[model samples]
Target chain A: MTAWDVIGFLLVLATAAGIIIFSSKQVRGKYPALFRKIPAITRLKRAVGLSVEDGSRVHVTLGKADLTEAANTSTLVGLSALHSIGQLSANSDQPPICTSGDGGFALLSKDVLRAVAMETNTREYYDPDLGYLSGATPFSYALGALDALEESGAKTNVLIGNFGVEAGWLTGNAEKHAQFTLAASDSLVAQAVFMATSQDFVIGEELYAVPAYLAYRPAHIASLRVQDILRFLVGGALLIGALLKSLGLL
Target chain B: MKILNIIIAVAAGLIVLLGYFFRIPAIDDLRGQLLNWAVTLSGVAGLIAILNLIFGVHWKRVKEKHERRGASLVIIISFAVTLVAGIFLGPSSPGFQKLVTHVQVPIESSLMALLAISLVVASLKILQRHRSWMGFVFFLCVVLFLILNSGVLAFTSEIPVLRDFLSAFHHAPVAGARGILLGIALGSLAAGIRVMIGSDRPYNG
Candidate 1:
């Protein structure tokens, strides 16, 4: 919108890129303080492991996000989580099942699933049906995914993406039927619903921390490091703005 | 192929992202074309998904004689009828539009009502099932907001302290929502940078 805003945006990206390079080159170092331990993420890890042992599939639903829309980043993060889970469960007796509400997202997820299946050398387990387009709209998504999930026989539900209050039905359904459930959403309303219904949930930026928790890659750690630094900067900016406002200098 | 894919992704991402900040005609033109392609791809993807839903999911269920075969059959029939009607009658036709307004709108409205009730039910279980300080705080906030927004606290607003409290209540959700929005924005920035740099590749499968 303005030069200052553009500079600030670029700074965030540059900072993330810089840390990613730095973190990747390090031979050994402690994980960032912010991501050292996240209970919800740790629980999701445990859920995946338990799923493997129980031979029950994990269900991941990427709430409807079009690539051209504002919520695409949320869907991308959901894909990150789904990719991690797919690899983790690729060799298991039962693999993970994923669903999306948007057609484009569903298409991309299907490709991701197939690729994960191939990489994990579990081609037999790869069903094109593994990734489903549950619905085209919000309410239809809830109803369609409810049926798809029920039929998948998945014991764990990992919902990460953009969702509406319609997510309440899905999370509520999981509460009754699922052995484990965790949710994260880009939509504030859906996040609130998840908190009320789901046993474990990542709120706000914590949704982006899933990859770091699930797979200890350098890039993932770098992402957390960048988030921590930027969050501090944002907090400082907010405080200064508040001070300025109170002093009538803003 | 992987290298080529990354190259293409990074190049397209860079061009599109920079197009907003830069005023070059070539870059803007390229960005527009890229965006158009993306939309086309999205539409095709949607079509593929519908086909998958019909043939891979419902049709299979029907053929397999699953317990939900009846529901699958109904979905298949409805999809066929809708597709045919839309093709013949055109989506702008009054009959087709009415089908949406009368049939789909009412169904969606009913689902919305159900979703609200479901949220209430989940709220009832929050403190009981969770039993954490966070759960208690969330539950308290929900009740507080509900009471404030329900007009029950309007009379109390005449009192000085109550008025101040009500003012804070009005702004509380906004403040909380703003904070969350900031966090989400930063998170998205970090994630987008990751993808642009090819450090994290969701498309790489």
Candidate 2:
């Protein structure tokens, strides 16, 4: 390993650990306020509440990527958000239906649903059918999801995960079905697609902030804080590098 | 059980993560072995998932007496036929290749072609809904990029203004894309750290 690689890895580890430890020790209401305006998150809250009140289902697609990849932070965050939404929808006759393209992800989604159901004392309503594989590939997954969402007549479509241009079709299909859609993904192209197709959408790392926005989990919130700090550091470093380059300094 | 799950996750993740950096022989061997096991398990899981999807859909159709039962039957027949053909005729055989090329490729292509129209409609929708500077700028960029890059207009490179605008616009979005990619990388790293330290455990679910 290069010196820089080690340093970078250690820096990330230390910062995250420090923040997590600090945040866990703080009492309720004592944690520092870290807030941002993400319309998709706001819409997700309203959609969940509305779906429960109106006796409609909420469908959450975890996109095409599985947990095996190194860069599957999107799926992780999506699962976290799904857990929170699952808990919120527990009281409803129809809880949220979580779908995934990968088999392992489907299994994880089911586990999350069961955990949420148990936490909410609604285990009887937990159905394995609610979380299962839609399709293996990206386009196939999109097609499968589109058909299922339309057939189910779900009121709320929460799509957050690693998707590509296929995401455009899913969002468009949801719109055609007159469903309230909230979309987010770690893929830039998919994020761009979401930006164009869905009014309530998240971009970039704002997706990682979903768990914090929904559940208010201390560690998740602290991770966001650490992310912000790292982002500023990286941005400042880039600025310095650019300035140095402009001055013909190495 | 929970501690064991955490232990397995941490050990496997650390071996893989650190093996990439340190050139330790034992760590590299362990990483390779674990990854192979993971791949094999993933394949089995994938097969199970397909079975789950097929039976789940078919049973639902039968119970509800949905008209799509015929479609589900067709899917089963097709899946069985493909599996048999792949196993007997070999995947590289002309039959398998032709089936994939003729069926799967076209379906994927149609979806992609559909995306072009979806993109345009989505951009228009964005403009209609937002009606703001950001929306206008985004709309203009998409239109300009499509026109200049897609070769919709029969314009020559001789036109200085069009050429300059096209050249500049082509690289403009790359800067933003790079920023987004970097942000995603950083976010993933932080997330990995959280998981490694047991602060966040998606596997528990």
Candidate 3:
């Protein structure tokens, strides 16, 4: 391979390693301030409380991406959110309903919820079908979620993780129906686009900080700090690369 | 049984991956056949889904006095038109093609355009909501990209350097965007792998 190819490959490895290390640390609880700064992270508790008081259900959507997918960040965020929601809802009369596009994710969502219920001592409230595996196609899943929103009569829709253009349709429908929507995902562009139109609260890269906020794990916070540093490094690299290229330098 | 399911799923996933990457004739042939079968099955599933939608809508309209009867009517009419066109003129016939060109294409394109416009407007709303520096930056980028994409600025060819710079800026973001997109694709692929292995079963419910 050429030198540039090697450097590019290394860059990717560094980014991936950075993500993993940061994620692991965040999982262990390292950064509290970052999580606190994110309004959605704080609103989660309030959302759960409101859901309980109003006798309304919480809708948690695991975007179409499954756990094995490279964008494991979304799944990680989704799982952490599920853990929080499950724990909060355990003592209430209602349990949060988790929805997924893929069957594999559906199954994992079930396990995650079950685990959360066990941890919170609300195993009796655990519903295996809490994680509904809708259709794999984007539009199909949107339709399924629409149906779910209507049927469950959920009050707060907490959408976190990977989503696509169809998220617009789901969020639009939710807004029309007056359902409170909170959305977050790592794909900033798509989520930002959707959040722009819908009444959804969007959490961007903040999704990576979710585990830290909910679990108060030092590793999770440290990882987030590392990720922020990496983001700054990447931004710097891009700027320098652009300037060098403009100056006719290699 | 669980082990059997895992083995079958892994084998299927491997076949799919191989089909995507390999150019061997046998593998290509198998992949083609598998794709055909998948298409056929998807068609069947589509039919089932359509039936369910019809039933659900009708039931809702009847039992719950749903206010969206117009939507149901539109669905019925569109389906009928497509079915009639397909039955009488066949897929490639002039009548069917006309139906596609006139009815389908326009509707689909217009809807897509509407979606794009809505995305732009919604993004603006989001910027207003967050009122953060990052949000403003994102909003600015999206607006600039959309304006350039619309080709309205191309009419200003009278200013050569300005036009050139705008064009370059328009094209420049795409390279970085593509890289980010590739990373997302890889991430999605890994997540798919985890799901296939049953390590993440969020949908068992």
Candidate 4:
């Protein structure tokens, strides 16, 4: 590795480790809001509560992100959100159904649901059927999810992950059925689809932030905090790079 | 056990990640081997899931006189036939390719067609509801993109100023898209670091 690569990697590692450690040690104060206001999250909370009261299932679909490097992070973020949904649906008559296009993602979803069930002391309600491999590709997965949504009569549909243009199909289906739909994606096309279809859609890093809001675990909060800091650092770097280029100093 | 697994995960993850950046031969070999194992395991898992879906879910549903028994039967037969054809004739064989080309391609094309309609409906909905400048801008861009591609305004390309304006307008959204993509990349990198460090353990369960 080059010196710059090694230095950059170590810098990030150290900074993240320090932040995580410090954040973990902090306790709640009188005014202890760790993150900024996300209106979509507030709406999500209300939607989940309403869905529970109305005896309708919340459908959570992690779109067609497989175990490849290009999509692995999106899958992980989806799983994190699924973790929150699992907890949210714990007391409800209808627990959230987690579906994925990839088998590996589906298997991981099952594990997350199982963990949630265990945490909620609802192990008996834990069903592997709840986390399913819907289809192998994006379109097939969307169609499969649409079928499930129709059959289950789910009131709330939360879609997150690496959906493509096919996300429009699922989100449109939800809207047509008058389901309360919220969506987030790493894909720009899918994000556009979500913005068009979902009334309250999480944008960009907001998908990762939802889990922190739902669970408020120190680690999740710390990770979000670090992400924000890193984002700012990137923004600063971009500005500086632009300035240097304009000045012909590079 | 959990601690051990976490350590293993971190170590293996670090090895694979660094192997990409660093040109260490040993780490590269290790990365390749681990990736192969992952792919192989994933393939096996997929096969098992397919079999379970066909037999454990679809077959059981058919046997139990479910409402969608016909659908279940169709799924099972199609899956079985595809699997057998794929195995016996080989995945590259004409039958398997034809099955994919005829069935999968058409389904994908249908979804794409649906996406076009949905996009129009969605854009219209946005205009009707939001009626904001940004929404109007989006709608205008969509229209312009469609018109440009439709070849109805192909003669506009002959006009230098009009062509420049159209070209710049077409690429404007792409710039915004690139910014969003950069943000996603940075966010993903940060999140991946969290996972690697075991702070945000989606794999824990």
Candidate 5:
């Protein structure tokens, strides 16, 4: 809202645009993996593949990410991962199930599923019921997901989005019922719970690294490149700010 | 059709973005209108989703003769009764408020109590499941913070070096958390810019 805030936003926007344009080209012809190995993503991908072979569904629960909040970023990350997984598991007997706590996000998730289904020529196997809003509130969402997870009988559970302390129930339930489970969230509180309960807890921004790891597609790779560049820029900014403040110049 | 969807979405997003940067009266009005429409649509979608979730879950159970059929019926009844009561008596009504205060709060509190127990069991299981150095370090850090910050050792604060060390330890998580938050912010910006450039479109699948 202030001048400095606007300047900062525009600075980031310009940098992102530059990197995105550059990386879009570089991602062509099998770019080398630029990211570290994430064990959680490895397990998540394997769980999806194993679900395909075993003919069980992979349950993807995206907790409430209201459009008006910053947590919607995590929802975008979730949607991308879902799309990648949808394409990867398109030929399976049962398509992955997507659940959300918000209706708008549920709609977006359903669209991603439908689009993936269409592109893969698996329209016949796709069901509209595959995507749904689970519950309205935090605890209700978790309790609702518990019932849904039980009913679906999915072997693999992947929970990614904006979760709160209420995620304890869903992760606890998944731990008990599912064969493979990995949970991630943008909320620090939820992340704490996940570290303790979930089979694989994706820490920090590794949640954002999911699509690049899962799909290995060009666009996601480009996004990842932009992210890395921005991280360096941010780290440099932090160091500069610290030095300036220490010298009484900031 | 896909191109049109992308264009429409991008255009609307641009307008919204512009509204944030500029405080012009006309742009502000337009932004308000657009946001109002979005809120209305979101509310309608929520209503539809709730109804679908309630009826669909219970209906499928009943039709399929699932073991939870009886429980499903009870849920359906509870949802309908609650909906009817909420609509007729209004959300601000004392009885409706009691439904939240008396029933919902107790249930949520019990679950929170369960979460505390779960946290303890999960920490123990962390050792059993993940015996790596990272796991050990994580467990050590958490336990160290827990014990140190709990005022269990007041004598340590009397020593200047120990007090300084403990103070720094208390602030360590904040620094780490701030670093993580910065990473997330950068990632969000990248993701949002991708949408703007049409490199990613989760809206139309």
Candidate 6:
């Protein structure tokens, strides 16, 4: 490999190490206090409560992106959100049903739901099939999810993850049924943006803050802090690099 | 059996990677054969999925005639027309190519264009709703990129300062975007590594 290639590879490795280290530390140490103060976390409980009181099923979608996809943070956030929703649902008469687009996510979602149910002492509510794997195709998954939501009479839909243009179709369908929707995705796709605007609440990178808010995972919180620090550093570097380059300086 | 299937999946994935990056004659031939087999399997899978959709929709229509009947009819008509045409004329035939060009392309393109328009409208709504600094920055970047990409400002080269500024901004944003993208890529890489190592075994069940 060339010298430039070696440097680039090392830089990438260092960044990955930094994120993992920061996230892991935050997960272990300073997450609880951070979780307590997040307004979005509080709103989630209120949403879940409204669903339970109205005797409506809580609809959760983990998106079509798999854990190995670039949007792994979305998967983590979705699972964390599910954990909170599952716990809340356990206390209420209405149970939560999760629909996933990826097989691996479906499997993880089931475990997350089951764990929450067990934690809430509502193990009986835990069903293996509670986490349904819809079609892997974007439109097919959206169609299946919409069908399930309509059939189940879901009152509140919380969708988080990476989605494509077809997400608007699901959001529009959900809205037509008068279901309160809170959706978030990191996708820059216009369709995803459209769905988010139509929903009651839409979170962006804020989706990554869920684990920090819910479990008080120190690593997750620290990771966010680190991400902010990195963002500032990168922004400064960009400005300086542009200035230097314009001046014919390396 | 599941373990063996997983092992085979891993091996096949590795082979595909090798086939893509390496330049060996025997490996290339092996890769070609494997690709053909994979495509055949994918075609079969697609066929099965379509069949399932047809059956599922028809069954729902049969069971609930009032609501699903229209959807079922549309599915049936689309399937029958496409299938019959393909079977008779074959994919490369002039008749099949004409249908593809005249009917399929226009319909698909129009639908895609509609979706794209909706997406743009939705993106504007997101900007209006969020109104955060980051959101504003993202929205601004997108608008600027779109204007430049759409060739609307191609005639503006008559203004020297404006031209230089636009060129500089374009080149400058690339570096910033590259940096941000790198951070995102690193974060994603970590997460993927965690999953592969089974540390993030949320799907282990």
Give the distance in Å from residue A246's predicted Cα in candidate 3 to where it truly belongs: 4.8
TM-score for each model: 0.95, 0.93, 0.63, 0.91, 0.95, 0.65
- Provide the interface RMSD of candidate 4 in angstroms, 1 decimal place: 2.1
TM-score (C-alpha) between model 6 and the true structure? 0.65
Each prediction's Cα lDDT score? 0.84, 0.82, 0.64, 0.78, 0.82, 0.64
Listed per prediction, chain B TM-scores read 0.93, 0.84, 0.68, 0.84, 0.93, 0.71
Model 4: residues with Cα > 4 Å off, grouped in runs: A11-15, A27-33, B129-134, B144-171
B5-116, model 3: which lDDT tens digit per residue?
Answer: 6676566655755655556688778777766775565455445444444454444454566676665566667767887879888999987898778975675566557667
Best by lDDT: 1
State the TM-score of candidate 1 restricted to chain B. 0.93
What would the DockQ be for model 4? 0.55
- lDDT by residue (tens digit), candidate 5, A1-250: 7897698668657855665665655545456646788888888888889889989988888988886666688888889989988988987979888889998887787788899888899989888778888888888788878777877888988898999888888887787778998898888888888877776888887888888898866667777776777778778988999999999998
lDDT of 2: 0.82
Instruction: Name the candidate, 1 or 4, with the larger lDDT value.
Output: 1
TM-score of chain A of each: 0.91, 0.94, 0.81, 0.92, 0.92, 0.81
lDDT of 3 by residue, A81-157 (tens): 78767777776867888776655556566778877777678777776666665555665576667767776788878
RMSD values for the candidates in order, in angstroms, are 2.0, 2.5, 6.9, 2.7, 2.0, 6.3
Question: Looking at model 4 chain B, which ten-residue stretch has the lowest summed lDDT?
Answer: B48-57
lDDT of 1 by residue, B92-112 (tens): 999999877888889888888
lDDT of 4 by residue, B1-205 (tens): 8788789888888898888778889999999998898889788777765665567567878999989889889888887888888999899988889988999899788779878987888877887744668667767777778777788878988999998988887788788887777778766776788887777777653
Give model 3's docking category: incorrect
| Candidate 1: clashing residue pairs, number | 0
Instruction: Please state the Cα-based DockQ of model 5 relative to the true two-chain complex.
Output: 0.62
Runs in model 3 deviating more than 4 A are A1-36, A66-73, A177-179, A199-204, A239-249, B1-146, B168-205
Kept native contacts, as fractions per model, are 0.76, 0.67, 0.11, 0.50, 0.61, 0.11
Q: What is the lDDT of residue B31 in candidate 3?
A: 71
Residue B105, model 5: Cα distance from true site in angstroms: 1.2
Ranking by DockQ: 1, 2, 5, 4, 6, 3
Q: How close is candidate 5 to the true structure, as a TM-score?
A: 0.95
Model 3 iRMSD vs. native: 7.1
